[model samples]
Target: MNLNQKKSAFIALGQFLSQFSLDNSARKEGVLHNDLFFDKFIDLIELSQSHNGWFTPEQVHYAINSWAEALTEENLNEWLSAYDLSNVQPKTVGLILAGNIPLVGFHDFLSVLITGHKVLVKTSSNDQKLLPFLADYLIAVASEMADNIEFVEGKLENFDAVIATGSNNTARYFEYYFKDVPSIIRKNRNSVAVLDGKESKEDLVALGEDIFRYFGLGCRNVSKLFVPKGYDFKQFFEAIYEYGDIIHYEKYANNYDYNKAVFLMSLFPLLDNEFLTLKEDSSYASPISSVFYEYYDDLETVKSKLLEDSEKIQCIVSNNLINRSISFGKSQKPKLCDYADNVDTISFLSKI
Candidate 1:
């Protein structure tokens, strides 16, 4: 359908998503096709963990809430206003999605469709259900969406361009396979925070949210910290103590125990909370239950190092210490315009 029609369908999906949250899933009147979709959506949320252990009901609901907040009419209008899609030609755009977090590749799916193109999605096995369920809701809201969205079980084919997200290894395969077509191939990138020893307890607590949310699977999650030398761990550890309950999750606890054992056996010194471990390292991508940290001599040197290694970083969280750094805990709550890897999806879609 046209732009407004497509936007309206997504708005309806967002409204549907708003009915569910970590605390409760309440059905609201006036939401489109709720009779057919609401209870089933709740069922899916309850069943999500069976499909993927990482898809805990709480985390799934958080993801749903995040998207609901993002897909408002005003937000959609503001985001799409920047692009000219009036003269667009429809093409089939293939997507190879990542299953790291619930509905992780949805922005790319929305991007392809909103730009007046057909979407051929190859869902990651870990996240095969959520987006297609939303797609069905969209089709029910606007019948034309049936023609615009398709999920492929086998290999992707007959698409003009592709958007693929994967590890650095799979990205190489995507680059070689989709080399002929204009493509956006995403690779592993991690976010980091800069600490100057002046952050308040509130800020550190919020920073804990950035660290522990979704159990640190998302690229936007702060996986590393750049702290000034001699920064005390007493305040930081106390501030993040609220997140200690995260250790109760079996998978997370297992990772914590295993990783900690490996670290100890290797003679690496560590700062251990009951739930999370902090190790001093220069690496950006930390293991699931740990966050790496480095000492920075000065802010300018850290900024220069980050700039020099920009391609490897997804986000920088700080209290205005670094240019373009996000606030303490806002990394995972990126705006619609916060393109991954700093690549503009809308502009890419408009051109293709």
Candidate 2:
């Protein structure tokens, strides 16, 4: 199939996703194929948690809403306008997805297919159900796409290129194993926020969304904080108190209890608000139920340090304190052009 055909299929998928939301999921009367597939999609979303506890209804709805907003014809056209895809040749691109969050690897899947290439996906065990179900939906919308998508069970074979997402350890293995093929091997990276003392209570509350959304699973979730030296924790704590209900979730409560216990046993100093804990550390990656923080004496020094360690950071959330930094609450709501790891997937696929 051609580019417009591919775009039309995804636009249809977007409309289908737009019908569902956390508060209300009424099927719209005019969405294509709603009579047949809409109810089944709802069934899959409801069954998602039984397959994986982390795939709660709230998280699933959030993912669906994000994609629904993204898959519009205007957004798709604006994103693709930057790339020259007319001369692209067809190839089979292998995808090894990470399952930290719902539909985490859908961007790469969309990229491969939209660029006139076939996709051979190997879904992560943690996220086995969601993507394949969506792939089936896409095939149903565009029967021609059945030839463009495949899910592999055993070894991945007969693919010309690859895109693999994993931890630093697995990334090394991917580099060595796919050494002969053109590839984009992603490693573990975490997002951080730089907080000035001047942020409003509203800003801090939004920051809570960045931290607590998806239970802090996705790489885009802010795992660390950079605050001014002697920054008071009073307002920060109060603003985020609205999200205190997050602790009631059984899995999150378990993590809170366990991590808090481990920290106390280790004699570590922790700032606790019952639901979330703040620990002073220099690392970018933090465990669930906690966020690591560091104090900055000067903004310029922090900027220099972040520039030096750019590769270790996925996104920097700030009030424009640093260049290209995202706003307080906007880290997780990435645009279509907000390429992961700052690598241009469309450009990469176009050349291949």
Candidate 3:
């Protein structure tokens, strides 16, 4: 699409989403602003949660706006310039969607769509409805755009290229089957936060949103913390605890307690029930009930360690501003120019 065409498409999609992304008070309700599509989205999320992702009706608007601009802004598609699509035709690709978090399939779907290829999506059982419904919405808005996309309910046996996401256990399967195709095999990754305990009271509140939103089910959620040694937990805990009432999910509470008991019976003392455990070692992802935190000697030392563990970190949220922060709340809410893994996806696809 040309720049003007892309701009118009995004404006339409954005306007559509902005309509429902508002709360009754007319304030910007990031996720709860669904307008007339509330029931459709809520039903899909209910089913999505049972299998894997814990999606709420609230985060959809942000997600849609992010997806639309990312795909058509022309940045994502620049990757395709490397390949000669005139002779390549529109290749069919398989996308094994990730149910780890909300709208996890978007990147893969996007890579295929903006690249001028056809996507045969294998929906995760837990997140079966959202993507398809999204596809429906896209079709309604721009029917021509939907022609290249297909939401497959089953496996991908006849695709030319592959983009599969899974844990270490399934990485081997991806390796064996997709070895013949040019593909990206993604595994579980943990997001983290780094704190020097120098954050202002206001910054901490915004940082709190990074930790608690979506109840920390996202990979971008800070599963660990890097704190200065001998740091005081009083302010950190209290500032965060003030938002305890914000966490009202019964399942999350149950998980917190069960994990707490396991740690307590073994003589582990927790700061509070509201926060989870923070352990050492490298765990790419954390359970919804707990977090694994680490202590640091200095910024330089921690910086070296994070570089060594780059695969484990996604977006870092910190007040230091020296580098990216260690923790964040939202997952994959990229600006128009925010590329995945800092790699231009469309450029990769266009060249294929």
Candidate 4:
């Protein structure tokens, strides 16, 4: 299909997603192919947890809502207006997706096909169902999309270039294996927040959304805190108390128990609020149930340290304390143009 046709199809897909929400799913009239996909989608959303325990219905719905809001005609235009895709030749782009969060690798999938290239996707086992189901909806909306999408079960070959997401160890394998072709190899990265001890209670409550969303699995989740020395945890803890119910989830509770036990046995001091634990750690990648924190004496030094460790960082959440930092609670809600690892996927696709 042509560019406008492709955009129209995705816009329809977005409309279909918009029908469902965390509070209630109100099926609206005029949505395409709902007779075939809508009820089945509800079933899939309910069935998702059985496929992956972390894929709770709430988390899955949140992901769907984010994508629905992102795929609007205006948002799509804003994101793609910078690229020139008119004269591009179609190459098959192979994708090795990550399953850390629901539909995590979809932007790359959309980028490859929307740029007129065929997509050969190897879905992460943890997220094999959702994207393909959506692809089916797209094909139904515009049948030509069928020719542009493929899912492989074995080795990925016959593709001009590849984009792979994985841990640092798998990245080495991707680098060596795809060394001959142009590729984007992604590795582990974590986000952090800078607190200056003056943030209001509202700010800290919003920051809880950043920490608790997706159960803290996404790279965009704030996994660490950079707070000024002698900062009190009292206000921060009280502000996030609203999210204490998160501890009631079975898997999260298990993780909390196990990780907390490990920390206690290791004699690491902790600030506990029954659900989440705060530990004074220099590392950015914290365990699932905990957030690591470092006491900083100078904001400028923290800024310099973050700049130096830029590669390991995915996002910086702050109240304008760090230049270009994402606002509190906004990290996980990245716009379509918020490319991961600061790598521009659209620009890469246009060139390839």
TM-scores, all models, native as reference: 0.99, 0.99, 0.81, 0.99
Candidate 4 has what TM-score? 0.99
Given candidate 2, what's the lDDT at residue 217?
91
* Model 2, residue pairs in steric clash: none
Q: Write the per-residue lDDT of candidate 4 for residues 1-352, one digit (tens) a residue.
A: 8888889999999999999987899889999999999999999999999999999999999999999999999998888888888888899999999998999999999999889999999999999899999999999999998999999989999999999999999999999999999899999999999999999999999999999999999999999999999999999999999999999999999999999999999999999998999999989999998999999999999999999999999999999999999999899899988999999998888887
Report, for every candidate in turn, its global Cα lDDT versus the true structure. Answer: 0.94, 0.94, 0.63, 0.95
List candidate 4 segments past 4 Å from native: none
For candidate 2, the TM-score is: 0.99
Give per-residue lDDT, candidate 2, residue 122: 97
State the local distance difference test value for candidate 4: 0.95
**What clash count does candidate 3 reach?**
29
Error of 1 at 352 (Å): 0.8
Off by over 4 Å in 3: 1-11, 25-53, 59-89, 273-284, 320-332, 336-343
Q: Write the per-residue lDDT of candidate 1 for residues 51-72, one digit (tens) a residue.
A: 9999999899889999999999
